[model samples]
Target: MELVFVPTPGMGHLLSAVEVSKLIIQRDRRISILILIIKVPMTSSILDSFVESQSRDNPYPTRLTFITLPPLSNCPDPSSFSFFQTLITLQKPLVKQAVTDRISKVGSPALAGFILDMFCTNIMEVADEFMVPSYIFFTSGASLLNFIFLFQKLEDDEGVDTVTKFNDPEIEFDVPGFVNQVNGKVVPVVFLEKEGGSSMIIDHARRFKKSNGIIVNTFTELESVGVEALFDQVSKNIIPAVYPVGPILELESKTRGGSQDESQDKILQWLDDQPSSSVVFLCFGSMGCFDADQVKEIANGLEKSGHRFLWSLRKPPPEGKVGMPTEHETFVDVLPDGFLERTAERGKMIGWAPQVSILSHQAVGGFVSHCGWNSTLESIWFGVPMATWPLYAEQQLNAFELVKELGLAVEIRMDYRRDWKTKKANFTVTAEEIENGVKKLMSLDEETKKKVREMSEKGKKALEEGGSSHMWLGRFIEDVFTNVASN
Candidate 1:
């Protein structure tokens, strides 16, 4: 069986696709894998680097192929295009033509199925035409997907104006499988908007309804309630098929090659030299860019807390520059005066660090995260607690799940302007709030530390052989593949 995995552009989406593809190859000896990506003009270089790295470290019997869809400069956002429409509408044929040509050469034996990103909905038509099954791969948590699925039902039942109550401060609605009634001002934000508040979500939800099956990057054990609730929602047959084969870090770690970059090696060495559970690592993700004021506030907050810390400061390039800050001096002016001198003995700052290795190290105690799903899962896997400061997208919702629902992290304050400003105007977290959150997590007192340690053990147990995630992954392979392929 040959499975062609198609992911939307972006590091997180592509990484999730790569991680799952790695696992699928491991589970089946006879199956072959190909990764299909849409190469946005200048951005194709990133995928080129990724393909080169993977080919050098092919851990599967199946060879990997990198095929590009023709450039679609006319699409509103070329990176966000779906399957058939984007390919069919383009002036010159790219994805469709290339795929059709490849199918002819590889023959039916090598044309088993397509594993597509959820946003790549148009692929279903092509899969049907080719007589191949296409599974939808959701790169976020199952809870998020469940919310998306439910949002469609709410919209259908309530109509577009279904809830004039949306803008209201608090609204309570009973979702099928959750234990508690969901409440929030932006509760329907998951399905209501696209591009984190645009009209794209409605279209994506529509696409989801037509998918063959859903694959999420989360395991069942970590969120039994949410996972079970998801199953319940789909049980009535209103939903497409779903599978939870995750704690995807397990697969990533397994396939991560031994070749480490020089900068990453330096970061690891610095982490190794720190005392166990003594340092806090702060990072706001790859795309998280702070204005000068916000950067100053982070420096002030960290200095006030007086904890040993390591931060990945990603300042946007100087005026007219294309990328991010590449030198240490770039942050000198933005940070507080005498900041390095005062914290010199206790802190080590870097432009970027080997995040996974640092999290796995014994010296790290807590994570200051942007609440991206991948970062959240990594934190949970390493048993390191988080200080959630979500910057964009469903991150705020994910933060709610972590701090309020899961009792796993602390949330910094965010400005909620029900009537005044638009959603883009995010108020910076005050130094006082950051200080308090840090003190709460880094408290040397054994009682608080013990509780966090206990939670970490629970996280570890979940990924083990008989753990919830383990069983769910096993069931996913058996139920999704074995049953269908044999027939």
Candidate 2:
């Protein structure tokens, strides 16, 4: 059987899709994966290199093929129109044509189904037209998916106007399977009275219901309650079958390639010289970075914490360069005066570091993360506790789930926000706050470390033979083929 996996044009989404595809192929040698890459402006070089490396390293390279869709004729600035919105509204036709051509040449039966990124739900129509099943690949955890489904139902039942009017200072909403109320702020900003936010979410929800099933990049052991919620009768009819086959993280060899550049080698050497569990690894996701003021504050915090540190700092993008990759240089200008010299003995600051390798290192005990789901899973997989600093997207929710629900992470600033128009209108996470968070995380209270280690073990075991995730993947494969055969 062959599957066409459609990934959004972002690093996190692309990586998850690729990892899941690899899992599927490994589980069933007869199955092959064809990745449909949607070309977009503001691509990540890291993403490009990762994809190239996957093809090179795969034992059965012939089982995978990557096809890039034609780029948009005149791509608009991503700030004005999000890549998600543009892909849904404008690029659907081009993508449909590409898939249609491939299917026509290969014959519909040769392709088992479509596996789509959550953001690429618009392509499900093509699946329907071809009379084949399509599944949604949620790149985040089960809790976020459950919340999104419940949020949609609330809006539909209560009326969009009524739902949009909720402006409580700290509203608490209940979703099944979670023990506590989800903080209102952690909900997506789009669901809260933004002009197009509600409609977009509702539309995605509607599209999600149409898919045959969902494959989430989280294991059952880590989120049993949230995973169970998706299967509840109340949701079973609306939400499709869910397959929790993950902690499907980037492979270590692929992540830590043999051909390390000079800078990566230096970072590795530094790590090798450090004591086991003595360093804190700090990295924001691809889109995360702090302004000059924030950078200085972080430097101060690291110094005050007095812990060995390895910080990957990126330069903030220029004004109006939203979604553009920002360049990073040495900390000569970005850090505080003499900060580097003062901490030279204990800290190593780099423009970029191999995050997977760093997280996997024994010397690294804790993570200061932006709490993107990919980063969250990576931290969990490596048994690294986190100092959570949520920036945007569902990171706030992930932070809440980590610190509040799961007791797996320490909190930094869950309520930090910035007004893009007014550069100064932002909440600064003070140096003191950063220092406390880092200290608490690095201290590694025995209980938190124990919990993280247990979850880490469970995550790994889930991918092993006869594990929960392994069984789910097998069930998903059988269902896909069975459903098509019945049709």
Candidate 3:
């Protein structure tokens, strides 16, 4: 059977979709996968990197295909915009129709089903027209799905002021099905904004409500209540199916089994030499960037914390673009005095680290992360506690859930939101906050550590035989191939 997978343009989203596609192919060699990447000439490097990464001693079947669409109206214009903007803006009519036409022309009666990223909801119309079963794949955490549903309900009922309640510290809304009260400001900017952003999200949410099934990058055990809550809240007519098939890191590891790449080797080597549970790994998600001051503050904070850490300090890409930073060398040179030498015996800093391998390392005990949903889930899967420093997008919400709700993380406060003026006026976090957060996470007491270890063990087991994630993936394949495919 042949299947088409459509992913949004961001690296995180692309990686999630790619890993899922790889897992599907791994389970069934007879199934062919085609990945439709929204073509952007200037940003092809990002796409190329993903392709190259997939080539290093991986078992993903050779039948994977990448089809690029021509620049068309209604397609996101990628000429000069940030990654997220490019993704949401690409709602061109011509491109949408072209994508529809291309899927229809797949030429095989054996075309079974489609797996589509949530942002590409525009594809659902085509799915309906073609009468093919399609699954809505959420590339984010279940909390995000919950937030989307809540935002939509609020907008429909209460109007603009209700949305603004998100930023009010005193106002907390009881999220249905879950006991936690959420701060309004933590909602993603996309859903709250008034301009082009809101429309895109609304469009996607509408499509999501229409899709035949829902697949998320999460395990059922991790958010069983939230998932069940979401299903309950959606309209009964369109609540097709929900599956939490994840801890996608395991799939990545399985796909990259026996990899011998130099980058991977270097990470292993670094971990091998470190004392067990003595190293901290720091990384922000793909799009997270700190301005020059924030970066220096981080370096100083890490130094002051006096911890043995490995930081993946990726430079900010050319101001607005997602490619390599133009002054990469100069950027490295601006580190605080003796930043390298002072931590010479204790820490290692690199541009990019093999994040999965590093996270899975025995020596690595805690992660200081931007709390992207994927990163958060990976930390849970590996049983590592976190020093949460959510920087952008849904990261704050992810951090809140992990730290406040799950007791798996320590929150580090910083002005992470986009309002520069507000950030300037109220950003109270400093090097001290970073130091304290790291110290707290790294110094989990024996009892706390034991609890963390227990959760981690449970998490790992879920990816193994008969675990929730494993069983869910099995059921998903059966449903998609047998039920959806037969239809």
Best by TM-score: 2
Which ranking of candidates, highest lDDT first? 2, 3, 1
Please provide, for model 2 over 1-487, each residue's C-alpha lDDT reduced to its tens digit, 9 standing for 90 to 100. Answer: 6788888888889888887887788878878888877766667466667777777777667777777777778776565625457655566677678767766874442778889888888888777777789899999899888877776777787665534554553878777768898777666555664555667777787788888889888888999888888878336487788889998787553443554566677888999999999999888877677778888899999999999999988766676555533534644487888998999999998876678888888999899998989999988988999988887777878888898889999999776654332233237888999999999999877988999999999998998998999999999998888877976
Candidate 3 yields a Cα-based lDDT of 0.69
**Better by lDDT, candidate 3 or 1:** 3
lDDT of 3 by residue, 274-374 (tens): 99998989887655446667768878888888888987776665554534332113245668877888888988877655677888889998999888888
Off by over 4 Å in 2: 44-46, 106-109, 160-163, 233-236, 253-260, 325-332, 418-425
Error of 2 at 271 (Å): 0.9
- Cα lDDT tens digits, model 1, 1-487, are 5777778766667877877777666665666677877765434565667666666666763456666566666654423324333543352245556667776874534566678887676666677776777678888887778777666666766665433545444667665545566666435343333333423565567777666678877776556677887787578776666787776653233222344365567777888888998999987765555667777788888888988898888656545333333423335567877888988888877765567887898999989887888888888777788887776667766776776667778766422221111213336677888888787777645654555566556656655778765565566566546535654
Which residue pairs overlap in candidate 2's backbone? none
Off by over 4 Å in 3: 26-30, 52-63, 70-109, 157-162, 234-238, 250-267, 318-330, 418-428, 481-487
lDDT, model 1: 0.67
Cα lDDT, model 2, residue 127: 77
